[model samples]
Structure formats: structure tokens, C-alpha cells
Target: MSNFAILITRRQFAITATATSRTVAQRVYVGKPDKISNIRPLAILKNKNDSPLETQLKELQMDTQQWHHKFWMNHNKMFSKSREEFDEKWFAKKQVSSSNQSETTKMLEPEDMAIFHRNFLHNNLEAQRTYDREWKTRNKKLLFLSAQVAFQRFYFKWFKSFFSRKS
Candidate 1:
């Protein structure tokens, strides 16, 4: 009877151990997807009636717009990831040094993000300025090209209408 009891206890222990191991193995961490990785380039629509110059201008405008979108998407994504990493490190350090022994580990809250925001901006001020300058330049170029295309389209339509009315 004693031998049977020992065998039963050993089997139960083996089963429990296997179940625990399976659960532990199944636990996995999944990080958030990168914002920039999801960005799709803007499509350029071309008209069959467009003149060579008009087509070129439209292409240029589309390219500039795509570049602008890509730049901002990549920059913002990097900034967000950097901020997250900083917050994680800060929270981990705080958790280690904090005197409160009963508190649970937690991520930085939304309210706490202001501190990181200010610091990040301060550190990246030069890069921010450069980005702003480049962004404005590209925007101006895009606007000018778009306006030119619109004006050409309007002038062509007006010329056709005037000639057709006379005929």
C-alpha cells in the first residue's frame, strides 16, 4: 500500500510539472508594429491627355508628396520608439531604487510622458529644426507644381471651349 501511494504521488508531480512547463513555454511577448513600416507610397494618377510638361510636373509633385509622407512617418515612428525605450528604462530604474517594496511594476503613464517629451525635444532640437526647414521647402515645391498643373489644365480647357464656340 505504501509503494502504491509513492507511485501515485510521483505520477501526479510529473503531470503537474509538465503542465507548468507547457504554460511557461506558451507565454510570449509581442511588440507593437513599427509605424513607418506600414506606410504605403501615394499613387500617382496620370491622364492620357496630359502634355509631357504637365505629366512631368505631376510626377514631381507626387514624388515630393511621397517623400514628405515617408519622412514624417519614419521620423515620428523613431521618436515614438525612442520615447518608449527611455520610459521603460526610467521605470525600470525607478522600480529598482524605489523604497516601496509592495508596489507592482508599471509602465510610464500618459501624465508622466510630458517629462520624457520635453527631454526628447530638447535633445533633438537641431534635428527637429532641420526637419522643419526641409519639410517647408518640400511643401513649397509641391504647392507650386500642383498650382502649375491646375493652371495649365484650366488654360487648355478654356482655349478648347473658346475655339469650339467660334466653330
Candidate 2:
């Protein structure tokens, strides 16, 4: 046998090890659906039915568009930081083995095991904190989206009322 496999670094080996264990996987999209139709369509203009409410509604829609743009921009910025934090906390630092231990002998002392467990617990705690932070951000975004949908439905109902009364 060649020594080619033995030449890989620990990081490379860890990556290959994890990659082989997965049976099925696919890329997932994390972006929120930003289509206007997905939210709700703004009031369509009626012929010769210009009203103050319609004007105000149009202005509010414009303001909402700006708010959405800002929200997404800020979310993208925060997302990067959150992802980095998650990665940092999720993976534990590689522990260097003493020179005396060989790859064949998988032996650990009680003190070493205790240290290992402590590190594991610390990493787990950090991972939980990271998860909570991400969950909060996701929920906040969901709430904002629900509010938008509610606003759109309300405005559309008002628009229909105005058009029906005008006819």
C-alpha cells in the first residue's frame, strides 16, 4: 500500500471522514421569497377613481419597499457574522496527542478524558448559544413577514371596498 492516504492533514481527514458518512444531501436555499405576489399585490388603479386613501396607500407601499430593502441588507450583514460564530462554536479545536501515543493505540488517561469532556461541554454550551441567537433572528424575520402579509391583506380589502363603492 502507498503512503498517499497517510500524508493527508487532520483537517483534510476530518472533512473526508464526515463527507463519506452522509448518504443523501442536497443544497438548500435559505433566502426568503421576496416576490410582491407572495406578499400581496398593491391596489390596481381604477379608471377616474383617484382618492386620498389610494394615494396614501401607494405611498405606504413605497415606504414598505424601502423598509424591506433595508431589512434584507441588514439581515445579510448579520447572517455572515452569525454563520461565522456558529462555525467557530460548533467545531472544537483539534487536540494534539502526546508523542508517546501511536495511532494504533487509542488510549486516554482519566485526566485527559476529563479535560476532553469539559471541552465537549463547553463547546456544546457555545453551540446552544449560537443556535438561540440564530433562532431569534429567524423568528424576528418570520414575524416581520407575517406583519407584511397582514398589512397587504388589509390594504387589498380596503382597495376592493373603495372600488366597489365607486361603481
Candidate 3:
């Protein structure tokens, strides 16, 4: 195994040990759809013909900012680091034996583990390194994100209005 791969493995172990001491399985987000009480498109713009030129223009401009601010304010808090009321129970440490403690863990040797790790890195490292690379890449095709999200509130408010009017 190369020096770089060893360093990464060491760092990963260190972070996992410091942040969480369990053999914490891979972190996965379970996509659970919320139980909606009501599912209806919001009223947005009035009918294209009925609304007066000046009034519609003024309403759209004001509604757009309101929608954008509301959405962005909500989005910013997803990765919040609030410690208003400390939750130390979750961070409490637990005892963990070394991997070789059990008979099952005893089967693997340092050399074999190192070789397996190297193979794993070679096969899967590209995905692990993507976020660090995505910004640097000039292949615009690879940057599959859209700027619409920043403008989502504005766009959706207008959209909801149009769709609601049609129905």
C-alpha cells in the first residue's frame, strides 16, 4: 500500500473514533416522505388576462423577494451547529476492543488487511474524492447542479400561481 492510502485510512479511523466510537455503519439518509396533511398548489399569479399591467408587475416583484428570503432562511439551518441546550448523552464514549480481539477479527493479518485496503482504495477512491474535484473540473457537463435553487422560491411562487389559475 502507498503512503497516501495509509494516511487516509489513519485519518478516517481517527475521525470516526473521535466523533463516534462504534463500528458505525456507513451513514445513509433514508428518504422518508413526510405525511402530508394537505397537498395543494399555492395561489401565485392571477390569470394572465384579468390582472392589470401595473398591479401584476408590482405583486410579482414583491412576492419574488418574499419567497426567496423564506426559502434561503430555511435552507441555511440544515447543517446548524446550535448548542443552546447541550446534548452530551449522544457524545458519551463507550469501550471498544481492538479489531483483533475476537476470533472472527483475528483471522485478518496486517499485511492482508493492508492489501485489501489498497485494492478498495484503487477501486472506490474516485467517488470518495469527487466533491473535492467537482469544483476544479472544467467539464461543465459534470457539474449537474442547477442555479434554480437560489431562485427556487421566486420561480415556484410564480409557477404555483400559474398552475393554480389554470385549474
Please list all clashing residue pairs in model 3, or write none if there are none: 44-161, 45-161
Q: How many residue pairs clash in each candidate at the backbone level?
A: 0, 0, 2
For lDDT, candidate 2 versus 3, the one ahead is 2
Worst 10 residues of 2 by lDDT: 15-24
Q: TM per model?
A: 0.60, 0.29, 0.21
Who wins the TM-score comparison?
1
Total clashing pairs in model 1: 0
In model 1, the Cα lDDT at residue 49 comes to 58
Give the better candidate number (2 or 3) by TM-score.
2
Q: RMSD per prediction, one decimal?
A: 22.9, 19.6, 23.3
In candidate 1, position 137 carries an lDDT of 86
Candidate 2 Cα deviation (angstroms), residue 110: 22
lDDT of 2 by residue, 1-167 (tens): 11212123454232111111122111111223444322222222322333444445445544554554555555555545654443333332334343433541344355655755565557457655765686577557556665764566567667887999999
Candidate 3 per-residue C-alpha lDDT over 1-167 given as tens digits, one digit per residue, 9 for 90 to 100: 11211112343232111112122112112122223312111223333332243234435444543444443344333212221111121122222243423433434446655755575556556644763364345224222222332244345557887999999
Error of 1 at 78 (Å): 2.8
